[model samples]
Target chain A: MTARRPYAGLIVAEVISDAADDALVLAAGMTGRILADLGADVVRRRGRDRGFERSTELFLSRGKTMSNESTGELLGRADVALVDGAVLRERGRAGLPSVSAVLSLFGGALAESDRPASAFTAAASAGLLAMVGDPQREPLRLGGHQEAFALGLSAYGGVAAALASARPHGVPVTIRASLLETLVWLNWKAVPLEGYDALPSRTGAAAEWQVLRCADGYAVLVYQEPDWPRLKAALAEPALDEPRFATRGNRLDHLAELAAVIERRFLTLTRREIHALARQHRLPLGPVWSPAEAFGEPHNQARGLFEPLGVDPGVQAPRLPLVWLDQAPARQAKIAVGAA
Target chain B: MKLLEGCRVLDLGIITAGAATAALLADFGAEVIKVESPTYRDPFRAWSAQDEPDAMPPLFRATNRNKRAISIDLKRPEGQAIFLRLVRRADVVVENFRRGVMEGLGLGFARLREANPDIVLASISSQGETGPDAGHVSYGSTLEALSGLAWVTGYQGGKPEVSGRDVNYPDQIVALFAAGAIATALRSVRKGEGGSHLDLSQRDLAAFMIGDRFAAASQGEIVTRQGNAQHHYPLQDCFLATDGIWIALSVPASALPLLSDGLAVGDSDRPDGLRKAVAAATAARSAGEAVSFFVALGVPAAIVNDGNGMMADWGEAWDHALQRDEQGLIVKGFPLQVDEAPLAIERPAPQVGAQTCAVLAEIAGYSSSEIADFAAAGIIETAR
Candidate 1:
């Protein structure tokens, strides 16, 4: 039997500022998108000149209705409100719903700071950029708006908790999530560990788990200390049996040579072949795939991971990551746009 | 009131993906009891504490704080019985074991529900519970590679890059999403919905993070890595400043005129030209001057900070992402804050079986004699 959607029969007001920081807009939109996907009647308050790319707009606006309602009108009917900091400031807490999630650039002590920040700057401030890419080169931001979307995920979690705990007509709950805090949370390991002298930093090739070139493309060589013997057996390469590569510490000392030895073997095998071998040996090897390749992956197709956005047959977005084993997938609401 | 003040969670999760999820719930005020087995310790406990053999590893301490812990030999029948007794009182059970480990231990979702009808069993895994790769072994970077996130994360025209072991991106983010999903499920149960088996896959969540790339790819957009350039910005890249610091800067289309005037770059339409001009201009100025110059012109800019610099800016840029415990050690903090009831670190990480006797006696209704018998038989462990 199909179970009811977790958030069915609820209304969410999404008021995002068009001229706000790009990350804030993206984060607010993503929070609304999650609510819409989870069966909420998410009404996205339309903003003039919010020139989002077609793909971003299509992905973030899925299952959400476009409306030109005033913030007062939307909050009057909404059970929850997802807004950017700008919108939250403009519409004070007096008129908000029982639950609201506010997205901003720098939260906490600097919540009111007007510092010019985007996702990249937030990532930089959070120390996320320093954790990726080659340490010798300039720090690189993670692909896409991870900092902002992480804030969105954090906001959604806070909102869900608020909903779970809310008493009907009780004191309004406001969740403040920011790109800087979210990124810092995600990159928590970068923080200095007490009594540890070595601070965490980027280690490109020296990384225990690294992406090395394979025959067809690239595969990330990942394994714990216990998997060393199994990795040696899986690779079937005599060079890996050297004493210098025995322990994790030893391997770290000879990382470049170790990576070269593994890459040499990987270059002889395709990603598919390497993946099969990884499965056979119970190794955690990962073969990097392009988005196009991943779209048609057999496992993804079997799991029904992606679905068309309905408005455009060619465009697709992933279903909500959560899967209720006994229930049918949540039905997508038809797109509705009121007068702008 | 705390968000989950009255909730109880039995956390069988280990390592990042599982343990962090439970930790987030504990931060939200759930009474999270971390369940571990005597025969097996969380791998994170063994990470980087070689100097102090008895001390909890920093990684484990970061994620396991605010939760009580107990050790049980679930392989024993008596231990399973004791666990079921705790299950009867738990509102949720979270685990990230290999696909069949729970069923092998006779504590699968069905058994959990049989013990407590409204139990929310969150099975967080590298893959879904019942897929072809469901039983596949994986780490965080492996999921990033397989889920198409690595495909998007790289230098332009370079091979795909993983966040590596240090910042296993997939593992950290999955905890956030899973916590939210668990909270949502709890809400459903509160609405009189029966127990739910939440099949959350880290790989699937990794894919969802880059859903826009997939959307564009599906429409034949040829979504390849473009380095630091985002479509929303006319020019964006990390440039070296005169002081040997790298400044990450983004110039919106609206700021192009100011950027052109500041950098003496004529053609804002040419992203390549603007990028070069910005790089040269930043190279001529100190990082502070470059960042301030850009900020004054309504451009987003910052010095790409290393770990120490990031920590130094804790108060100004952020406040609570990392906090000091009673011992004055830095630990993981909240990603979000609630205005009414802010989350906090109420306690430090527990030793194995630290709360076994108290939880067994108070929550499981086990008498001292029964607890002693179980302890004597090696069915459970109690901290000395």
Candidate 2:
């Protein structure tokens, strides 16, 4: 038989928070979901009145069992616990498991501040809001609940490391992960580069790589220095042969004109055609596919990348993004969410 | 005590995805030795500052701190022998080269397991190690485009937008997840399981981040770009204030009454009307005043901070994500802090081959004369 999943016998407790912030709930719920996917027994404790969007609930509550056990009782039996700052403070260190990851809005010096915050506000504070979109317009937040989910990723890493080193009856450890810290960590390039006085900002039309309109939808024009020759050959337009677009520096100096020349060629081709050309030339071009359209993509279908949600057979989510080469491919047993 | 005090890792990682993962392991107290070749240094070392050869680029310094550096030309048989010797002493090896580079160098998983049966080899790539498009060339935004993230991330009815070269979202998050997977594999090794190869794909991870959208779409739900309008929030977007600063505000349904009373708008029941009223009210006051007002009333609001504004709120909003080193140079910091065994920057980034002599003598069991011979034969490099 194949070796057991990594954390098969591990038990995790996910504490619920009554606060109305979506970020906190998502972070805690996501941490539990990751451990559950790794074969851990995750028990999600529910408060009487807390509610989440149906999609969020369906994605996060997979492979988890709803529990009515008190926080203290759950901690007593759990090998690990995922909690928010408020819950951690409410229960104190005495009632926590040997390994506990505390999710908070702000950590370190501002750990106790009760300022109202959401994923949007956290993104704004972390300088992530200033990185995307048109420079002339207001900066845009990323597509989904990225800030909260990133915090969940950080917490999971810390918990995994702690679990790797934990002894049978070792001293307890508290892992602190926060929304602001996690966002900043992801956007670390926003911090001024060493020896540079000015910080990097959004480049809009000036960026070397950009999404241009195609016959169907949109496709990003992407190519590194080495792929420049192939990109020019694929487009096969005379304007690209202009002296002004001879080198990377020259092309940057006339980025808009260069984009116009390429986009003129792209507007006639569909996204699939562009993708096929990229594959042929070994270029890094990417065609933007809506979630609905992505379901039918040949690559995704071939990889079997998505799995159906247990609660609703019609719904599906991406499987865990890792594959162990040594083990046989075995589907995870789907556990339905039940009432506490 | 440090969490991973006794763990030894041979870092064959380069650039953001691989190097940053090793850096996190270093932060957790693992002994991570960064390996490069004299002819092939980490491209990040010259990413920016081509004009001044001696100056370390910010990206390189930020991702490579807290580890010692050694140079080995793995292409040569002698160099491969030395690397296998080091591998024998190491518990893990991490790399993110294009799909077949390691195999071409003859240091593939089979060879690594031959050197040490319990070694954990983490192969991080743009696609997976065994897919039809496994050899596809990609950057972070390219993966974002292919992974269905950019599709849902834009103004309503507008074209999709990437985080661009500056933010490269996939490269950053993959490091976090890859490090965790390595740790889990280490746990398995400690439990007597044999060696394993971890296949981590950035494109797959980018899709996983937006997994809920996929779930909805697979169920025949039309999951199009909704901009900043989340279903749970009545109104959420950025508005420019009188002082010329943009303020992001999110209003929950429960706060509709309070928001209507505060802004004196009778049309708060409608989402569009509430958004217009909030925009109008925000445009009449300074960003700080508007943020404070909404926050006091239990609404989520904040000023959209640029880099400088982020530095201004460093201590209060966040403290350790970006930190100052011994010489007051800014470096990458931790995403999480352990209360008992807090992570820290023990040393700054090293020069190429900075610890070659010491590592060869101490860990690889090479004597001083053998190291001298290797240097003479051009198989290894020592820091000048």
User: Quick one: best lDDT, which candidate?
Assistant: 1
lDDT of model 2, residue A283: 94
Clashing pairs in 2: none
- Interface RMSD values, listed in order for every candidate: 4.7, 4.7
What does DockQ give for each predicted structure?
0.50, 0.48
Full-model lDDT for every candidate: 0.85, 0.84
After best superposition, candidate 1 residue B64: deviation in angstroms?
Answer: 1.1
lDDT by residue for model 1 over B61-177, one digit each (tens)? 888999999999999888999999999999889999999999999988888878887788999999888667888999999999999898888889877888888899999999999
Per-residue CA lDDT of model 1 for A10-72, tens digit only, reads 898888777678777788788888878888898988876655677788888898898888878
Give lDDT tens digits, candidate 2, residues B1-384. Answer: 677777888998999999999999999999999999978998888787435778788789999999999999999999999999999999889999999999999999889988888788999888888766688788999888989999888888777988888888999999999999898877767656666889889988888888888888877788877777777787888889999999988787777898888877887777777778888888989999999989888888999988888888888888999888788888999999998889999999989999999999999999999999999998999998
**Candidate 1 clash pair list:** none
- Under CAPRI classification, how is model 2 graded? acceptable
RMSD in order of candidates: 3.8, 3.9
